[model samples]
Target: MLTYNLSNIGSDSLYEHLYKCIKKDIVLRKIKPGERLPSKRTFAKNLGISVITVENAYSLLMSEGFIYSLPKKGFYVADLNDVQPTKQVHQETVVLTSGHTHYLADFSSNQTESEIFPFTTWIKTMKEVLKDNQKELMINSPCGGILELRKNIATFLKEFRDMDVKPEQIIIGAGTEYLYSLIIQLLGNDIKYGLENPGYPKTAQIYKSMNVHFEYVNMDSYGIDPQELERKDIDVIHISPSHQFPTGIVMPISRRYELLGWANKVKNHYIIEDDYDSELRLGGKPLPTLQSIDVSDKVIYMNTFTKTLSSTIRMSYMVLPESLANEYYKRLSFYSCTVSNFEQYTLSKFIENGHFERHINRLRNYYQKKQEIILNAFQSSVLKNKVEIYNESAGVHFLMKIKSKKEEKEIINNAYSKGIKLNPLSKYYSNSIENNNIYVMNYSSLNSNKIEEIVEKLKQCI
Candidate 1:
């Protein structure tokens, strides 16, 4: 008889207690590989627990790879060292099912609402580009990008952003992620990268995955603190000064100059300015890029068409310093990061014809209207006293700071159950133990009706 003490189990649920006992034995290697477990009925009877409890524990053990079952035989301790663990392919299936169900509102992504997309105009432009640039599409262009697109980008920057960039300085790639990845590889290793705390998680995840040393610089209402940055010995700083993600706080000109001064003081250091959504600034005059302020060739500016145009475009470009541009071309000579020639040629013509400007103006006006609706709805809500909105004047999303953190999950769950999805503030933090009561709600995807409904539902939840 295997002498096992049952009196020590303290869990309220018999199955949970039994599961832990077997899992502990398996982990400690006391239950040798391929050792058969007691039959479910026998084990349950011996322990004075229901048979279903033992079966449930065994099923869980098998699912988690702690044990295995043989045909018409019994469950045994698994040889974990040699076990081919099952991939979690089913995890996404459940999420997909839940996502497809028609919801009253969804404020998750920073994308323009489905109804706002200029589908007809885009299709017309795409067809024209394909027809006129068919010959260019047949062959591969330079890795840096087609000359026409580069020239158009330069002109666009000059007219709109007051950026004095040339075609030679522009390098086109699929998206911002790809462009940033190239920078990481080109810059080599052993350099410290700095990111904004409570900023875009993707930026942090990519750097960490590359095994790069990085620090999170704390952010304030004015954006990332330059004084705090002086304390850390960082080689590069990545910032989204135009419209900071999640918070939507724009960096003031004084701080921008200060940051530039910091980079100038440190020799060979770089700053990556991610102008992800600057084109959508509704009220004030659009700010000049950090690259434009670079007197010392310290800032590398990158922007994407993903936000302004459409996500499917897969087009983004960077304006590199003359020194860096030369090095990049020489290093990436064999590797091609150029987009499709047809698409580039089409986009060039689109901008040259002034459609791009008109498109941006239309979107600016549209977003302004949506922003107004959101502001009005929130102001009149019952939860107005309990929650205060931040970053409402700009960007696609706004942050709602609650009075307490206790109801954070409750509110999220209630909203989710009502077909409204929200991202909790804690989700954005690397350190979750910190007390944060903010919730990020994107208005870009919500229509006026959806926005009103969402606000009313949120009021009830609070």
Candidate 2:
């Protein structure tokens, strides 16, 4: 008979507790291989629980190859020829979904504040889209996403970014990570690729995972050094030109032209312009995209709603040159669009009705004020004399050069121990080029009400 103290299940459900207890016994061979499990009713009576709970536990065990069932013969433990004991892992990792401890001042996260989302307006737009697009919602989106959404995006780009692109030239996917995979397949893996050193880590991680041949090209003060690309004989170069990550250096017009000229010289040379947070630029008009200036069809432009909209949106898109767009359809049209029809229709209506634009305007104002509050807090902090802020105008994050003699790793660890998560600039680099004593401070998600406490925590970290 199977029995467990049901009263001590704690937070777990009865079935779940029984499942774990039985699984543990089976792995330990206390419930031997080929041993018959008690009938659901009998086990339920033994443990003083419902028959459904016992049945649920048995079902889970059978599903996991821990046991087997016959029509009338009942459940029996499977032969345990190769099951191994579980290795020790962090308790929090097993129990908590986020896997990291909450921090008082999390300068490592770039997540947008949840309060900034216009849920009322968004839900209203979704309802409107549902009411109007019933027939369209039933149909699957095309490989390049729905025509309506693409059209709205194209119009938005022209009006805001000054880039004239046709709907056919855009490709929508679940996220930038998915789009990067498509880019790799569209552009042959045989070519050499260049990524900016000390750039976004995920970009490098994606290229490496896909078995792509890529090199880290060092950046000068302006942005990616075109002269280095020439020296490296790179084929495809990925850069965040409008506002570079961590450093927040916006590419000068001269450097943008130089990169375009470099791409023009070679037959298949191309540049990938990742204009991630251009919409949230705090000062002046956003910079014109490199694609808008490229006459030779050498730039593939990419952006994501994860910055402007909520991170949970999982929507991103790219603008391909006309030639590449044709090539993409020819080579990869069989794959269906990754986003759902409902989301596409809703977002299309949201953009077409000006809700998205209004939301972005509101968000820009909110973030600008948040930035001001945090900067003011830092200015008044005890560590104000020990830190220098840089590139505070553009993205949600910027660099803070700390005047400390401690090694970067030691400083970061000290901060983490004090509930302040800090990410050093040196950690982003792949090569030996050192960027010491600087940390990237992402403040978009910081709680403005806790600014004083957060500043005190930062003071302690320093």
Model 2, 1-462: lDDT tens digits are: 666776556546567778999999998999999899999878877876556567767778876789999889999999878667689665421222353335667888877777888889889988998889899989888999999999999999999999999999999999999999999999989999999888888998899999999999899899998889999999999999999997899998999999999999998999999999999899887778999999999999999999998878999999999999999999999989999999988899999999899998998898899989988988987778989998878878888998877766556644654557787888788865454789899888788999888778667656
Q: Which 10 residues in a row give candidate 2 its minimum summed lDDT?
A: 92-101
Backbone Cα, N, C clashes tallied per candidate: 0, 0
Q: Candidate 1 regions off by >4 Å?
A: 1-102, 404-406, 433-435
lDDT of 1 by residue, 17-89 (tens): 6778888898899889989999887886676544656776787787777898888898888887896767747
Give the runs in model 2 whose Cα sits over 4 Å from its true position.
1-101, 432-435
Task: Tell me the lDDT of candidate 2.
Answer: 0.86
210, model 2: CA deviation in Å?
Answer: 1.6
